[model samples]
Each structure stands twice: as C-alpha cells, then as structure tokens.
Target: MANQRGLATPLGVEFAPPHRADRIAALLAEQDRWSPADMPAIHTDTHLGSAAPLLDHLRALKNLSPKAAALRDRLLAWDRRMDAQSTDAAAYAAVRGAVVRRLAAHPAFAALAAPPSCPEVLLPWLALLPRIAFALEHLLLAEELYEIDRSAVVAAALEEVAVLAPAAPWGQSHRLAPWRALATTSDDEPGLAGDHDCVPCTSSVPGLTDLSARGPAARYVWDLARREDSRWVVPFGASGVPGSPHHRDQLPLWVRGDLVQVVTDFEQLTKESDV
Candidate 1:
C-alpha cells in the first residue's frame, strides 16, 4: 500500500503531510490560535469550526415573513432535538422536514436548480455544499421551487456527497486529490463539474457560506498614481533560480485568500533564509 501523504499550496509553500493531523496542526500553529470570532476578526481568526455565516445568511434572506420565521425557528428546534436523539435517523427526519418547509416557501430558492459560482474565500467549505443540497431536497420540498434544472442540482449534489458519504466513501478523493507539485497524480476527479451548482447564490443548497462566492484570497485594488504603488511576486519566481525562488510562488495563498507578502530581499528576509 502506498503511503497517503497529502500535499497542497494552502500558503506560499507546498504542504505535503504524512497524515491529516500534521496538516491541521501546521495550519493551526501558523495562525497561533483557534476558534470562531466576529466578522472583522474572522478574517484573522485562525480557526472557523462552524458553518454559522452560511446559516445566518440563509436565515436572513429567507425569513421574509412570519411563515419564514416559523420555519427557521422550527429548523433550529429540530437541530437541538437531534443532539439528544438515540436514533439519528428519526432526528434527521424531523430536521429534514423543517429545512424542506423553509426552502419550498421561499421565492429566492427558485434559483437552486442551476450551477452557482465558486466564492473565493469559501472554497474550502466546498465539501459541505452537497450535504446542504441533500438537506434541501429531503427536508425541504425542493421540487416546489419549480426549477427547470432540478435534476442538474441533484446530480451535482450527489457527486459531492460521494466524497464524504458514509458508504464506500471516496478514499481516493480524500487520499489522492488536490494535487501538489511534490505529490503523485490522483486518479479521482473532483465531484464538482462546470455544469453543477457551485455558488451559494444559485446553488440549490440552503445555508451556504458567502465565502463560496467572493473567495478567501486577498485582492488589492491598487491605485496607479502612487510611485511605490505596484505589485510583487512570491518565493521570488519560477526556476528556483538563485535570487528568485519562483515567481508567482504564492499562488496557493492567493487562492486561499491569504496575502502576506513573501520577503525576497536579504535585508527583509528572515535570518535563517538569509543565512
């Protein structure tokens, strides 16, 4: 059996780990602390454990009337009930009903049958997008939304579910996917396809995080008038040339919405790297 060492460019450098815990620990350590914080702080906050932003956004947008409020409340109530259930199935069913009612009655939900955009910051949350869809269809009468592309959404959601679903889970998906320059190529394909719903705005799944749309990358709107105003490269540059490690080396950080500058100059670089 091949060792399942995973690699990714989550930050500027290639992150290949012998185990998931190693990667998680590296991430947590880099940030220094963990736990969800309010919005402004959320950007700097090292760890975000819950899908609160998605739920809050959905509740805000869908709760247009007293009926919507009642539905939302019921959904919350069911969540609490699920915590105490001896049989998860019964709890899931009740929770599912509330989600369905809330989704079916909302006008905005009409758009779920089509593919949605992948938000920048919320890309990591992509894994959960399908589960959200499953809840929508099973709990909420998703068909009542009357989408011409209903089946399209279901198919896309199922693809995502295949990655983490209990039965015959995508060991390859988890083990070999998300390639890195240092790692071996993966045979497994990502569950998401161009035709599938990929964004919170158009996705059939409710309670999606807004990050799915904007992305987590730092985007600078630089004003050209300033003299010092300009852009720079990361890890120096490609070729791993003596002076420049590699141009556009920070691609992963950019993808993940992290934008700390890579120090290239001897005066600015860390002591160890300079030495």
Candidate 2:
C-alpha cells in the first residue's frame, strides 16, 4: 500500500500530467511578466470545438474593426491557398508552416493586457489565455503530422476546417463528425482511450452551441487523516474576491479534462497545483 504517491491499493491505471501550451498563460496564472512576442493561447486544448469563436469572428465579414478585418482577410487568403494544395501530409504541413509565419505577425494576435484588445473582436486573445495542460499524448496520431506542433498545424488548418464544416456539434453529436471525436465526458481517471479522449465539458447536452455557458458546479477529492491532501475546485476558480486572477482561472483545466489541487492544509499539504 505504500508508494511514492502515498498509501493506497493500486488500481490497474495511472494518470499523468497534461501539457500547457502558451507562455502567456504563465503571466495570467501567476501574474508573471508579459512580453509582446508571446502569442496568447486560445482554446488550444480542444482540437475540435475550441476554435469556434475564431469562426464566428470571420462570419461578420463586413464592418469588422481594423484588426479583426485584417486577420480575417489573411485567413481568407490562407483558406484559398490551403484548399488548392496537395493532400500528401508533407505538402499539407508545408502550407500550414507558411501560413502560421504570417499569422505570427498579424495584429489580431497582438499581445494585450487581457482579451478584447481588438475593437468589436469577440475573442480577446490576450484575456482568453486558458492556462491548462493539454495532454498531447491523447491526440489521434493517425491523421496528424508528427513534425509540426499540434497548435501550429491547427492555426494553419483551422480556417479550412471551419469553412468546410461550419456546423458546431455538441455532446453526442460528435458521432456524426467526419473524423473521430468524443462527447463532453468524464470517465474514471487513468484510462481514457486515445480516440475517445474527451474534454471536461459540464454542459454536454445534445444541442447546445456553447461549452463555456456551463461548467462543473464543484469538484472534490477527499483525504482523511491528512486533510490537507484533499483538493477542491469550483466551476471557474476560487479567487472568491472580486476580479482575482484565480477567480475565472481554473476553467481551462476543467474544460480540458484536468483538475486543480486546492490545499485544506493547515495540515501542510504538498502543494502541486501544476495544472
């Protein structure tokens, strides 16, 4: 029963940590310093629905703010260019590589104090940083190229996927998707199949259009003699004070299928909030 993790009868499964993508997320989570060069993280956790906001941004094609319009125009060009390319994975990846280089310089992705940096821009890239560890080990390798970072390919390919398949499928609607997908689900930890990997979606109703509207009301892990080891999380965050960075902070973890560890330790809990 004794092990590095503590005392417990081992189950057949073991859970590991997920990876975080953006450096700006560190600035948001720990109030770390910000640099203009760091591109913000936007829904990088979910390969499927997280980029839906970017799609909506392009829908109002006319009268968008200067930055929004600027970004849209470039994406449109990228969209056309991406579609004309060959399907060989190498060629597909090369196109993305070129597109992302341009994306890096665009104004829409400009680093700001918080999101909503662009006028009339629905997705505030800066404020939208979701500081959650994304477990890339679960992504489907069959259809993806290993040479490129997942986020980079997604950035290059998103416009194409959105323009080609514009519908936002929720919950069980994932089954209808052309590629493999999973519902907003919580399976017993330590054993989620790679193809069936799910996000921490609390509102997984069949027809909902938005995942952010709902979340885990609360989450918990109980510990006995050493009460400090117990952890808890509310829907978003526990920065109970108004406008605390932590108030809406834990959401990314919750959505990306992970949990934050809260210490009840007057009991000296080994703090590992590495989400």
Candidate 3:
C-alpha cells in the first residue's frame, strides 16, 4: 500500500503502517530462495529500491511467531514465483496466481474487483502507481528481458499503464509541472525553463520505452534518519483534483529533482479528510 491518503488530501490511498514493510521483505527473500541462480537483467536505475525492505526482515524471520513467519514465507514464495516475467512464462503465471490469492483475499480488494481510477475516490484503493512503487524491482530489474530487449521492456511497461488507465480520470495531466507549497493555484500553464522535462528524459528510464518512464501519478522518498532529510513530491502537486488551480503544482519540483521536506508538525498543515 502507498501513503497516498493523509490529512492534506482525500484523492490518495492510505498506506499500511510501517510494519507492513516486512511483508514485502519476507516475500522477496523467499523469492530469491526459490528462483534460478542467474541474476535477472534490469532495465533502469529507477527500480533499485524494490527489494530493499526485504533486507530488514531477513533477521526478523529467524525469530518470529508462527503467524508472522508463515505470512512472511508465503510472501517470499510469491516473489520467487513472479521473479521471471520476460524470459520465463511459467514463473510469471505462478506469481500472478499468488497475487490473486494474496491481494484479492483482502476485504478491500474483494469489495472492488477493480480498484478505483484515483486514490481519492476510494479509500484504501488498490491502484497502479502504489503497486509499482513497491514492485518496481520486479518489473524493471528482476526480469531478464528488461535488459536484453528494449521492445520487451516497452511492452511490459505499457501493460501496466493500461491496467490503471481506464480508472484514471485526466491521467494525461501527469506532464511536467511546478509545485507551490504556499502560492496561489492557477490554471494557466507555467513556463518551462531550467526545469528538467520529465516528459521523456527524466521520466523515461534511458534504454527503456517512454511509456515505461511514465509512472503512476506520484512518487516520494522519506529518509527516517533525519526529519529534515526526508523529502517528498508528487507528479502533480499538493492537490489531486484535476483542473483545480492547485492541481499540478508540484510538477517543477519533481522535474527538477527538488523535494520539499515533510512537515511533521501537525499544527502547520491542511486537514481535508474527504475530497
């Protein structure tokens, strides 16, 4: 799950508590245990963080309750099943099935056979970008085809976008834009200067398809070691509603690779629970 939902906006999905990071970690470790010894080829630098959480859980797995261990192992097994997407067709199916069994079993996924197009419209919404944010390694790195053939990477990337495009409203608005934390919102197009054009170069991972670079609506990085070191930004801006003046305010920061520090003080914030 992504930390899409918060006090500031209603158009994003709420993230699972920090404890949930272990689930992904356990699954990845299990995946490595079962997968072939050959390292799968990777397509881009953008996906390095995919399996990072698993490192934290490996030690924890040794001393865990039965329930915790089982969950972790199952997730690991699932990762192994999906590790081979491009060259290994059999492995892909296994992983997909595991996802259906695991993710679909959740009440939230069950209620919506199809996740909402936007996170704001559906609480705990299971959408594309959030899923990609966690599984980027698998999609871009773990699979061998990611590096061998550029065509394969492009096709795979398009498949992901197609999955969520239907549900996404005005999703095309993800073009590069600037973010204003305290400035007034406006509908006029902002000038693009010195701003990295996320359209192709920055957004698209080199050697991969342009579509592959187009990520789900937003991205963020939180460095827990230091509160000030933690920085965040979205493809659009502080607001999620499209056509609103506040919409797409953060485009410039994202394109420029500039991130705003997370404001921990609750008093200095906007609390809008619902869109």
Candidate 4:
C-alpha cells in the first residue's frame, strides 16, 4: 500500500510532458519562455557531466538569496562590490580544488589517475546544487559517471540521506545491495532519452543513492473491454516470504518492464482448499 501514495489520477494519464516543441517554441520567443522547449518531442542534451552544453547557458533569476552575513561579506571583501554573475562552466576554476581532493580519497576515483580537475563544470542555481554537496560531487565526478562499468557505485551513493522501511526490505536493504544493470537515464536527462522504445529506465537524482530512489512503483495496463486481459507489474514480486520461489520471482520481469496478466478467471488463479 505504501506504493499507492501521492497525486495519482484515476483516469488515463500521459506519462511524458505534454508540451509540443512548436507550442513551447512560441512561448520561448519572449524569454526562451519554456526553457525545456526542445524536450519531450526530443530529450534535452542534459546529462550528468561537466562537459554538457547546457551548463554554458547564460541566464539568471535570483541565483543566490540566503547566506550568512559574514560569508557574503567575505565574497565582497577586499573592496569588491559586485558578483561577476558568469553562469558559464569555466568561470569557477579557482575553487574546484577542495572538491577534487575529497573525491580523490575514493578508491575507485584514485585508481583512474584522473586529472585534478574537470574544467567544464559550472555554477548553477538549483536548490540541490548549493544545499547538497553530492550534486557538486556528481559534477566533479562527471567523467566517471559516464563510464559503462559502475560496479563499485552499486552500494556507494553517499551516506547523507536516510532510507526507511520494513526490515530487510528493498529500500532499507538496497544500500548493501548489488546492481545487475545500469540505465543511462539520469536527473537532467529523461530515461527514454536516446531510444524511446527502450524498456529499461534507471533514472536517479543527484546527491542521492541510485538504488530505490524514484521511478514508477507500479505499471498497469487495464483492458477496458476484457477485464482479465489487463496486466500489471511491481518493482518486487508476489511472495513476501524471503526464500520462496514466488518471492522476487517477478523481479527480472519488472526490471525488463514486463507485466503479468491479471488473474481474473477464478479457475485460473490458485485456489486454497486443502493444500
């Protein structure tokens, strides 16, 4: 029942953002009014990397608001008066060292012999950017995040956030869990970015663990004319018992975006009598 939470609708809903490129293009004429004008019809160039072109976007709307008086004073110290307000990636080169050192401690990061800096990173105004350090970590680790082999990150998504649930359940136990696959989808990029037909979509928000984060909890295809023809799938399986065959049986199907038909016919479903 926990999965059945939030602003879900009873009627048919379009999963993708509905705005068309042409309509959004018109709105964006004034101020690039619909910033995601190129989206949905086609995914954005956004990705988890310092090299993305989106970071070079030059626009601002109150990028910084709250800060300690002393900190603000320090930024304005030495008779400096105004902030440069350059939104470009390369402008913040001076302060990238601290982040580089922190990531260097990770064994996976150290093994690569990566450069001290990824110069393509930028300053952004997202709420997560300033409040959370992992966003910066992702920005700094963009190079590695793009790689094919992410076996080490299967259990390492940072420890700052809390995971709660029934004991040994996925949300609680996934921290020590292993990863069988890695989907290219990410926060800045839609899951179905390159291949719209692809079934696997492993999107994860930055500054958070990749496992059990956010995605569709369940998928359903209700057949209106024939009720039993309907099909559905959940992230886990049917049996709650840990070692049962039915336990986690549908996990592979769920990961592959497959569904199980509804057992509406009384005779087809298991009937508990004397068993």
Q: Give lDDT tens digits, candidate 4, residues 130-174.
A: 222334434433555444232222112111011211112122211
At residue 223, give the lDDT of candidate 2: 56
* lDDT (10s digit) by residue, model 3, range 91-134: 22222223323333344434445557665634222453345433
Reference-based lDDT, each prediction: 0.31, 0.33, 0.36, 0.32
Query: Which has the greatest lDDT?
Result: 3
Q: After superposition, how far is residue 63 of candidate 3 from its true place, in Å?
A: 65
Reference-based lDDT, residue 168, model 1: 23
Compose the digit string of candidate 2's lDDT tens values, residues 134-242: 2222331235434334444344444443344322222222211111133553322221100111222222211111122333356555555455555555645765443
On TM-score, who's better, 2 or 4? 4
Summarize candidate 1's per-residue lDDT along 52-107 as a digit string, tens digits. 32234334443134544444444344332111112222222223333433443345
Predicted candidate 2, C-alpha RMSD? 19.2
Ranked by TM-score from best down, the candidates are 4, 3, 2, 1
When 2 and 3 are scored with TM-score, the better candidate is 3
- Per-model TM values vs. the true structure: 0.24, 0.25, 0.27, 0.33
Off by over 4 Å in 2: 1-201, 204-208, 267-275
How many pairs in model 1 have backbone atoms within 3 A of each other, for residues 3 or more apart or on separate chains, i.e. clashes? 22
